[model samples]
Target: MNAPANQIPLQSATVGSDDEIDLFELIAVVWNGRRVLLGLMVTAVTLAAIYVGLTPKLYNASADIYPVNTIQLALISPGFSADAENRATGELSPELLFNTALMKLHSENMAEQFLSTTGAQVNPQGANPQTAKQFLDALSVSKEKSGTRAAINLHGTQPQETATQLKAYLNFVSQAVIVSVSRDLLAALDASIQYIDRSMEQARQQAENKRLDKAAVLAEAADIAAALSIQEPRIDHLAHTEVTPFNDKLYLLGTRALQAELAALQSRKQKDAFIPELRQLEAAKSALLMDAEKVRQHQTSIDAFTLPASILAPTQPAAPKTALILIAAVVIGLIAGLVTVFVRQGIRAYKIRTQSAYMAGYKKEILRREGHYAVL
Candidate 1:
């Protein structure tokens, strides 16, 4: 027959109670694997420590500023009929502060300008684009936030470089961006609008000239009417002294002619009204005057941002990042330990199951004492 029906495998863990683990056994397992565990731990920790040690010490540089409101509120209401938004509405908002940070990282114009302003010319030593990217990569930004404090960080390998970049960012961009558009600048802009005012005055004058011209033409029409009236009376006198007293037809005709002449003179004023050219000119003048005034009003001066923002120096220097390193190490170690225990315990469990099957006859020994038949 087979070597024994119950003959089973060994070389695995979990052979029932024999393989059940206690604290000492766990310690023993860990100790047994110590060489391997120690090797791995040492390798990992050493590599980590080495990497961290080799990394260059970073120094953070940063600056802060805010937009400010310079315009008086009274001037805002009548013009745009909207409340002028303040630049620095109370303290500097986190958003505007980040705006400054964005300029540092993303604003190509600002970045290029900063480089130029700082005299950072391309390296003449034949450094390629990759080298330049690498150098720039050395720069990093971090946001520091608290309940009532916030700051942006500019980190670099070199302390002076950090300071220089921070200073440049503060001077070139922050001050201008943070402050509300200055009143002086607004005034200058308004002065430019005065040119539009001058145009309006000229337009008004043109309208006045058109009015005067119309009046003068009407006055000439009045003179013609007066002359016609005077001639009509003379014509009536001629009718009254007709050559033949019996020539009633000529007298009647002269009377009608006098009436016709007076009527024609009175109608001259009405003709001036119907003159198409003069009517068009008057309409044009009125349109131009209305348009010119609108242009002047639109060209009026306005302030840009309402409230201004201002930032003082940082409340404190950048925090130490050593805590991050420590946390990282602990996390890495924990993962390693957990994985090691699972692998070792699983193997031990499998061996115990195999050995318990191999020791199947031990169950028969107990069953026989109870007078129970047991299969081999």
Candidate 2:
């Protein structure tokens, strides 16, 4: 092995020569199958082009809704205060209102409502359950990561129509919130009004009962004065006979005054005037009624939340990306072309190797037979 230093250089040269020859053979294989490779590539590109062309185009439209700004908050604050007495109606804070609208935007009930209302024109098949479900699925409502805003997105064949529908859906959600809150507010006001009415009625009844009791006391005193034959004030014996309060002894006013007071009390018609709390109760009731009226009058104008920006229809189609599809086609075509070339070359090489081995075996057998015949 140590005597082969010169042969090592020769062996290395032979290895280099074999590697060069293999590289050239590979190049030859590719060159000879150029037609097949080119055909496959062209076919792949053509099919991709056809598929891209036939696909329908779609456009996306999105609208953003943010929490109510201070201006809108100020506008609706007075209305919310009207229901302060009944917390069961819930507070309509800006965050709660915004969340409510966002919830309604994604709710199935809203989908059905839109389908029956504005969606009818877009989808004339009417709001069957299936249709409503499909419409709901088409809608996308997502809150931004910052949590300050939410977005509603939709895609369709017509950009303008899609944008219009999205805007209408937003309006529908806003209106739904307004209607729900207004209804609760009105109900609370109505309950307050009823409660005030009951209180006023109770006050009037108590006042009337007190008036009747006073009249009875006056009647008894007048009878006692008439029996004693006293027609005028009798302060002469008041201090001497264990003097009590005047109210405890109405007879001291004499029969004439007592009779007059009794007649007046029996003839009183406006008992409410005697009820001290009646005026305050009436004022409160009037205030509640006014609030309810104001709510009704301005319910339609109330904006629960604000739109931060306008929803614009995208001018470009979102689907059927032309450049991307063409580039993908080229890449796929190139890959298919190379694969086809290698596969064909490999099959041809395998066939040639098989034939060469068979031919060598047959020639060896013929030589053996000729040698056998010569020996014979």
Candidate 3:
């Protein structure tokens, strides 16, 4: 009386077969959903083309920087020691200096300085902090691996603006470094001069004290010689005095004692002499002052660094490459089309499943009613 027990199982088996899609089924799915796939591809391509057309073209300007040895840039002061020169040389190596300059190109401070100093084509109205950050964002720096040369590249909407910004950025970094080093040297020179002054003052005071002590010793000897009945002018001969029988024993003893005291004082004075040291210090101070002057002169002589002739001029239209954009659009269109095909196939498959289940139930109801009629 009921529908064949196998009917439901057979229908389920058919549904399972439909779900087990193979290459032919996949091809059918795509063919059935061809319209949808076409629509998606057209839409994606159209949107991409519109966006590309609306986007402004960008220009790129690049400048080559040949980093001069930082040591050459800085004038060594007269009193700069060999050790100091070695230290400076290490810090100013071509590689180190190039990296330092490269980093400065990206710094916010350098960006702001560049903006303030020159007429930037992108932000001709003068830039605020936000615009300055944008300026830094638009910059790129690269250094040569084997040489002291570096490169600065900048992007902007205008070719002239791009070039100007690149030049300004390079100038700002060079000036900043020179100014910083010059300031440091000036400070060091001042410190050295102060130290020298202090040393000279101490030496002068010590030498003056020794002379005063010597004078006091001489005065004491004079008084002792007077008490012993020895003449002031005749004290030099006291060391060679001939013992006489008529001479008072006390007088002879006092003369010998005075001679010993005078010798001791002369020796002490010679030992404490700081004159040679003072002269050397004075000469060093003069040399340092000369070096400081030279440094100042060098600061004044700073000119634009010579760069390689290989500097790249700004390209008029550097971005939104047509071929590249078209290629990207094609890739995106293909992806959208594939997605559309699968989605359409899934919807169609779901509807077929619903219709098949509905028919199966209807057939089962009809068969049940016929079985009841036969029983009646």
- Determine which window of 10 residues in candidate 2 has minimal summed lDDT: 80-89
Off by over 4 Å in 1: 1-15, 32-36, 69-105, 120-150, 175-204, 218-376
- Per residue, candidate 1 scores C-alpha lDDT tens digits across 1-376 of 5587788756555547674558887777777766656565666667667777776556655543333233322222222211111111122234443444444444555556656665654321123322334334544444445322234455555456456555555455543442332323334334434433454455556655655554444344435435544323355555556433223222233334434544554444444354344444444345334433433443234222222233233333343455576567656765686568669877987999899887887887777866754342
Model 2: how far is 122 from its true place, Å?
3.5
The estimated TM-scores of all candidates read 0.46, 0.77, 0.69
The C-alpha RMSD of each candidate to the native structure, in angstroms, is: 13.6, 6.0, 7.0
Q: Could you give the candidate ranking by TM-score, starting with the highest?
A: 2, 3, 1
| Tens digits of lDDT, candidate 2, 1-376 | 4666566443555556743547778788889888877887788778888988887677788877788765565433444332223323234577878887888887888788777776455731122333666667667888988768887788776787778777777887888898887788788778878878888988888998888888888888888889888898777856565522236576877889989888989999888888888987887778777777876877788666786346787899877888898788878887887888888887887899899999999999999999999999
Number of the top candidate by TM-score? 2
Candidate 2 stretches with Cα past 4 Å from truth are 1-32, 73-90, 108-120, 123-134, 224-261, 308-310
Would you list the clashing residue pairs of candidate 3? Answer: none
| Lowest-sum lDDT 10-residue window in model 3 | 82-91
